[model samples]
Every structure is written in structure tokens, then in C-alpha cells.
Target: MSALTKQSAEEWTQLFDERYKRTAWPYGSAVWGKKEWVCPDLRNESVVSMDEGGSNLFWAERFGRELGMNDLWVKLCGNSHTGSFKDLGMTVLVSVVRQIIADGGTIRAVACASTGDTSASLAAYAAAGGIPAIVLLPRGKVSTAQLLQPIANGALVLALDTDFDGCMAVVQRLSLDEGIYLANSMNSLRLEGQKTVAIEIVQQLDWNVPDVVIIPGGNLGNVSALGAGFEMMASLGLIKKQPQIVVAQAEAANPLFRAYQRDWHFEPIEANPTQASAIQIGNPVSVRKAIRTLERHQGIVEQASESELADAAARADRTGMYNCPHTGVALAALIKLRKRGLIDARSRVVVVSTASGLKFTDFKLGYHEQRLPEVNALHTNAPVELPNDYDSVRRAIDTHSGWNP
Candidate 1:
């Protein structure tokens, strides 16, 4: 740590950029590319990586035009091995566990309670490291794709008849047993990798900071991790300005947003079910860390209704972007903030897309079919059925396209 502080910001930037360009074993992986900043003491062979991080920071040209903004972007963190931002953190957690075990520590298995993405990421990384993994999930809450990933990876998945908070309780208890190591975000090792997203965002933008960064919050660890990245950069003189951090939440499960409304007084609620299942957490373990980070940066917490999020996602999907429900929450918040004039038209803004839309096919199908509860389905597009005739097909196509004969 002291060695890193001795180097100037420009030196660190050059080093990171050079490492990013290399195709070496661990340097090719973004997390390990910044190993000195991440897990400095861990041996190179002990690291577990899947080339996580370095996700695309896409320019939302058409979407920005629709939002009346000229400088809007979406950081697609889901474009990774496990198809979510969780891959970034899980790599670090599992690598540290592998290192501990290799050093003669008696860790028999790694365990976590997840709504979906976390379990999938942990399972995949643990499997990659040849370590046993156990995941506790809230029964009937997670998407089918999310559940299948852990199962396919051979993780001991327990579907408890409870919500995410309940499952978290059980996992916490299991971690008390000496043999089972906890792999949740509450473990700071996860944040070491997750924080790399912030660095990557700045790096992708040529070391320029945006005016605002909005991320969908559930467990709240990611937001804090985001802050940690910026804080580290600032401490090292990499950046002089800090962007306003915004946290978007599903209104049904918005404990943080509620706390923000109440002058930062926090209280856990019984989280109601929402389509953004990955963020369906009510009592987030990192709430204190999140609040502290938010207090440091000029932070705001906003929430989206089910209708708002679904409509926002479908609306953005029209612009060639596939968004998960969690991303929809952030998009909806952006729309609201834009409408309220809190966000300027010329300000550069980036919305963090937490998970892949492919993982939530059911949500997409439910929206288009107009089946999801509380969603208005304003942008729903259903397939048109035509008879097996050329004239009939032509007529249907003409009608749909509003073509004149």
C-alpha cells in the first residue's frame, strides 16, 4: 500500500493502461490487471479470474436524444462470464479464499445468500477454483436462468421458503462454522474487485469523470465500492473532481431511498416482490458503508415504480439496448431526475447496467404479453400473426408499417 502511494497518478495510469493492453495470463483479466491495488499480497498463481471488468461504456446516442441529453452513456457491467457485475467481485472473493486454503487455512467451502446474480458468480468462480460452494436462495424469487447457473456449476443450492433477508440470515449463521467461508459483499474482499468498475469507467473515458453516475442499489455494497474507487483515485491524485453518485431502487424494495427521504435515518422494511429480483433486498448489509460513501460524495437516492421501470426498460430497448429490470430502475430514476431538471441537459451522465437482460427473459415476455403486475406495458410489441398467403402477409406487413399502396 505504501509503495503504491509513492508513485504519482500519471505513473499509475500508464502502468494500468500498459497492463490492460497486454494479453498475459493474469494481466488480461481487469481485476488482476490492478492486482497491486486489489490483492497486493496474493500470489499470481492463487488468483482466480475470468477476464471480468473492462465492460463497455456505451454511448447512448439515440437514447440520449430521446431523453433530451447530448452526453449520456450506459456502462454495461453485465457483459461478463456470469453475465452480471457480480463476476467482478466474486473473482476477488474466490481468489482470496483459494489463497487462504493454499496457505494451509482450513476453509472447506464458500457460501453466500443471493437473490440470483451473486450465487451464480460465486458458484462459477468457486467451480473454476475447484472449491466447494453452497448457496442459499429465496425460493420462487430468482429467475430460472439465475437458479440454473449455480445448479449447473454444481453448487449446493438450498431454496429456502423465505425472502432474501431470511436467506442472508441463514448464510450468516453457516459462516460461523469454521469450515464455511462467507462469500457475500459484506466481505470487503469482494469490494476490492467491484471497485475496479469505477476505475474502468474513468479509464474508458480517458481519465475524465462524468457529472453523474447512477447505479441500481440492492445490497448497497456496489455503491460503496464505487465510492471507494473514486476515493482511492482522489487520494492518489488520479482525479480532482468527484461525480455525484445516485442510487436507484425498486420502489417495492427501496429501503435506502426511504432512508434518504427521512434525512438519512434508516430502517429495514419487509421487501415486497419486484421484477428486479436481483435487487429485491430490504435489509442490505452495507447500508452504513453506503450511507457513508453517499455522504462523502454529493449523493441522491431515487426510486422507480414497477410501471416506470418496465416502461423505461422497454423504451430504451427500442434504441437497441437490452436492459435488465435493475437497469430499468436506474433508467427510470434518470428520466425522473431529467424531468425534474435536477440533471442538466448538457451534463455527462452514466447509468450502470447491473445485469444482462438475457437473464430475465420471463420479465421481458411478461411485459410484452402484458402480464406483469403493475406494469402499464406502454412499449409492448407483440408479434403479428398472418395467414399462409402472400397477399395476407403483404397486407399485414403494410398495416404494421403504415405503408400506402
Candidate 2:
């Protein structure tokens, strides 16, 4: 474990050059690209993966133009096997569990408390590796699509009556048993996998680091993971600079944002329900790691209200990107930062889309139908009813779309 932390710039660079150039998958996986840096002790056969990572670092030219930033990009982490960035971390966590079992460790099942994505990813990877998994979820909190992932993967899903924090506490206590292992972001192994997003971003940009990177914050693990990735890159001579990171949060559940507002005097909050359900974590387990990341990287924490996040997601969808509400939080934060002059319109930026928009169809439908409470649908493209006639259809199209015939 110390080897991962104590690796010098020269040693890291050597490993990067050797493995990063591989054409085969798993080796080509950004998380495993520098396998020596990630899980070096595991043999090829011991590795369990769905070829996660290598997600598209898409150039959001239209959306960038709208924001007056020509170099804006979206790291589409939603494109993973589990349809969320959680797959990146879960692959690593579950892989390590498999390696441990192979090495004579006695673990019967892996368990985690999830908002949605974590359990989905964990269950899928554990199933792939022939490992049984137990998932704890906040009852009626997670999206239907998210809840289905773990269930479909054959995990023992337990829907706790309390919120995610309660679920976390239960899972943590359950993992105390020697037969079960915890697969949460608190585990440093997951950070090693999540950090590869940073490596992949720089790699996709031909080794040119971006000026700013914004990611949604719930657990705060990703913030620290990204920071760790950049630190490792700089330490390994891969890059000369680190990006100014922004951890975007939903105002309804923004403990880290509130901490930043108080000049780093941190206090956890009782997170309220929000449309960005995936990040509705009040007391994040990785708050300390996130704070350390902020201190080291000159980080910024920004919060987006429900309406702002909804509007931002809708606006981004118009530009050909179907964004999850969590991604909306990051985009809203980007807008807020731009207004505050923290992020210049001219700077190259990347906003991480944590999960697929398809997972939140109900939220999207409610927004377009003007049904969600407290959210003003500023750009609704609602379907107009029409009679089944050419004239009626033409008139509805002309009226709704504002195109004169």
C-alpha cells in the first residue's frame, strides 16, 4: 500500500510509458493503463473488468459556444458499463476483493451503501468476478433505473427505510464481520481507479492538462481521487501543472460547499431531497479527503439550487447532450463560477457527467411537462396535441415550433 504512495516521478513515468502504450483492453483501460500504479500485485487472470474507463472526452463545441468557452468538454463517464462513473471505481474495488480471495483471504461477500451508482457498479463487477454482493440502499430515494441495476445483477439488495447516511452506517457496521468487505469510496483502492479519469482526460488531450475541471460532489471521494490523479501525473513528470478543480454540489445537500463558504470551517448538514438524487448525500464519508484536495489544489466548491440544476440540464440537452441532474449541478456550478469570474470563459474546461440521462427519464419528463415542484421549465419542448389530419398536424407544428407555412 505504501508503494502506491511512495512511487517517485521516475518510477511512475517508466510504468506509464511501458503499460500505457498497450493496444489491448484492460491493459488499455485507463485505470489499468499504468497497472503498476494501480494494482501491480494482481496477475492478468486475477483482474476483473468490463473494459470500463476510456469514456469519451467529448468536445462540447455547441454548448461551449453558448457558454462563450470554445474549449469546453464533457467527460462522458455515463457511457460506462454501469452507465455511471461509479463503474470506474467499482471495477477496482471488486478486483482487489477478488485478488484478496485468491491470496487466501476469507471473504464471502462484498457490501456497500449506495445512493445509486455505487451499488449498481459493485453488483455488476462482483457478479462478473463470481463474487456474491450485498447492497444497502435508501428506500424510495434512488431512481428506478439505478435500483434495478443491482437487482438485475443478482445482489442481495436491502432497501433500508432511512436515508443514504443511515444505509452507510448499516453497511459499515455489517462489514465489520470478517466474512464481508466494504466497497465504498472510503476505501483508498477505489480512489486509485477513480483517479484514472484525470489520467484519461490528460491522455485524451494529448497530455495537455486542462485549465479547469468541474465534477459533481456527493461523497467527495471523486474530488480527492481526481486531485490524487493529477498529483501522481505531476509527480511522474507526465504533466507540469495541475488543473484548478471545482467540486459542484446540490444546494440541498451541500456540506462541502457550505464549508467553503465559511472559509473551510466544515460542518455537515442534514441533506434535503433534491432532483440530483445521486448526490443527495448530507454527511459525506470522504469530507476530510475532499478538504485536503481543496487545500492542495486551490479548489472551489459551488452549489446549485434545484431550479438552476434543472435548467442547466435542460439547456445542455438542447446542445445534443443528455445530461443527468447531477451533471446539471456541475454545469450550474460552471455557470455560477463564470458569473463570479472564478472560471474565465476563455479557459479550457471539463465537466464530468457522472451518470446517463436515461437513468433519470422521470426527472426529464417532469421538467418538460412542467410538473416538478419548484422548477420553472424555462425551455420546454412539450408535445402539442393535434387531430390526425395534415392541416391539424401542420398547424400544430407551425404553432409549436414557430415556423410559418
Candidate 3:
């Protein structure tokens, strides 16, 4: 840490820029490109990477225009090996496990209780590193695409007849055995890689900080990880200003939002089911860390109902984006805040899209079919049914699209 601090901020920035341009083995990876800042002690041979990070910071031009803003961006974190931001962290966790085993450590396997993305990432990274993985999931809660990831990666998948909180409880107990290492965000090692997202975002934007960054919240570790990155940059003079962080959550599972409403007095509740199933956590393990981050960053916690999230996601999709329901939660929050004039129209805002919409095919199909409960499906784009004839198809398309031909 002292050695890095000794270099001027300009030198550090130039070093990072140079590393990013390199096509070397680990440097090609966005996380390992900043390895000195992330895990300097970990050897290159021990690093498990699928070149995660360096996801697109997309310009939401049409979507922003709809919200009366011109500077809206979405960080597509899901465009990775496992189709979620969890890959950013799992690479680091699995690498550390490999290093420990190489050093004669007695770790047998790594395990985690996941709503979805974490297990997928851990399984893939563990497989890549030749380490075994065990994943406990709340049966019937996760999407089929998410459920299949760990199974495909050869992890010992356990489908428990319990909610995420229950699975979390059991995994914590299981990790009491020294051979079974916990791979959840509570482990802290994962955050070392996840924090690199913030650095990457700034780097993509030429080291300029955004005015606001809104991220979907579930177990809440990512929020703190995001904060850690910005805080580290400020400490090292990489950024002069910090963005106001916003944590968006599903109303059905919004303990953090409730806490924020009650002046930061937190209490866990039995979460209700929502389309944003990934974030359907009743008791988040990283609640304290999240609170500290929110406090330091002037954070705001906002929630979206099932209908709101569905509509918001569909609306964004209409503007050429395939947003997951969790991204919808953040989008819905952005809409509400914009309507309330809390966010300026010209402010540069970035919403972190945590997972790929491809994983939520059911949610997308349900919305388009207008079959999702409580959702109006305001932007439904159902296909036009027609007889098996060219004339009929042309007529249907003309009528539906209001085209004269």
C-alpha cells in the first residue's frame, strides 16, 4: 500500500492505462489489470480469470431522452463469462483458494448460498481453477438459466426447500468446518475483485466521476464494493469528487429501503416474491457495510414494486436494451427520482446493470405476453398473429405498425 502511494497519481494512472493496453496473459483481464491494487501478493499462476471486467459502459441515449436526461449510461456488468457482475468477484475468490491449496492449505472445496449469480460465478471460476465448488440455492426461486450454470460447471448443487436467508444460514454453519471455505460476499476476498468495477468505470470515462451511480441491491455487498473503489481512488487522488450512490431494490425484499425510510434503523423482514428474484433477500449479510457506504456516499435507498419494475424494464427494452428485472428496479428508482426532481436532467448518471436479460427469459416472455401478475405490461410487444399467407402477414404488420403500403 505504501509503495503504491509513493507514486504520483499521474504515474499510477499512466501505469494503469498502459497495463490495460497490454495483451499479456493476466493483464488482458480487467480485474487482474489492476492486480497491484486488488491483490498484489497473489501470484500470477494462482489467478483464476476468464478475462472478466471491461464490460461496456453503454450510452443510454434513447432511454435517457425518455427520462429528460442527456447523460444517462448503463454499465453492462452482466456481459461476462457467467452473465452477471458476480464474475468480477468470483475470479478473485477462486484464485485465492487455489493459492492457499498450492501453499499446502487444507481447503477441500469452496461453497456459497446464492440467489443465483454468485453460485454461477463461483462454480465457473472454481472449475477453471480445478477446485471443487458447492452451491446451496433456494429451490424454485432462481431462473432456469441461472440454475443451470453451476450444474453445467460440475458444482455440487444443493436445492434446499428454503428461502435465500435459510440457505445462507445453513452455508454459514457448513463453513464452520475448516475444509469448506465460504465464498459469499461476507468473505471480503470477493470484494477485492468486485471493487475493480468502479475503477473500470472511471477509466472508461477518462477518469471522470459521474454525478450519480445507481445499482440494484440484493445481499448488499456490491454497494460497499462500489464504495470501496471510489474511496480508494479518492485516497490515492485518482478522483477528486465522489458520486452520490443509490441502492435500488425490489419493494418485496427491501429491508435497506425500509431502513433508509426509518432514518437508518434496520430490521430484517421475511421477503415477498418479486420478478427481481435475484435480490429477494430478507436478511442481507453485508447490511452494516452497506450502511457505512451509504452514509459515506450520501446514499439513497429506493425500491420498485413488481409492476413498476416490469414496466420500467420493458420500457427500456423498447429503447433497444434488454434489461433484467433487477435492472428494472434501478431504472424505476431513477424514474421516480427524476420525477421528484432529485436528479438533474443534465447530470451524468450511471446505472449498473448487474445481469444479462437473457437469464430472465421467463420474466421477459411473461411481460410481453401480459401474463405477469400485478404488471400492466405497458410496453408489451406481442407478436401479431396471422394466417400462413403473405397477404395476411403483410396486412397484419401494416395494421399493427400503422404503415400504409
Better of 2 and 3 by lDDT: 3
Model 1 residue 149 CA deviation (Å) reads 0.1
Q: Give per-residue CA lDDT, model 3, range 1-405, as digits (tens).
A: 677899888988888888883689798899999998999999999999999998999899999998999999999999999999999998999999999999999999999999999999999999999999999999999999999999999999999999999999999999999999999999898999999999999999999999999999999999999999999999998999999999999999999999999999999999999999999998999999999999999899999999999999988988889999999999999999999998999999999999999999999999989999988877887777767899998877667862211
Q: Name every residue pair that clashes in candidate 1.
A: none
What would the C-alpha RMSD of candidate 2 be, to one decimal place? 2.6
Q: Give the Cα error of residue 243 in candidate 1, in Å.
A: 0.6
lDDT of 3 at 268: 97
Candidate 3 residue pairs in backbone clash: none
Each candidate: how many clashes?
A: 0, 0, 0
- In angstroms, how far off is 17's CA in candidate 3? 1.4
TM-score of each: 0.98, 0.94, 0.98
If candidate 3 were superposed on the true structure by all CA atoms, what would the RMSD be? 1.6
lDDT for residue 40 in candidate 3, whole number 0-100: 90
Per-candidate Cα lDDT values, in order, are: 0.94, 0.89, 0.94
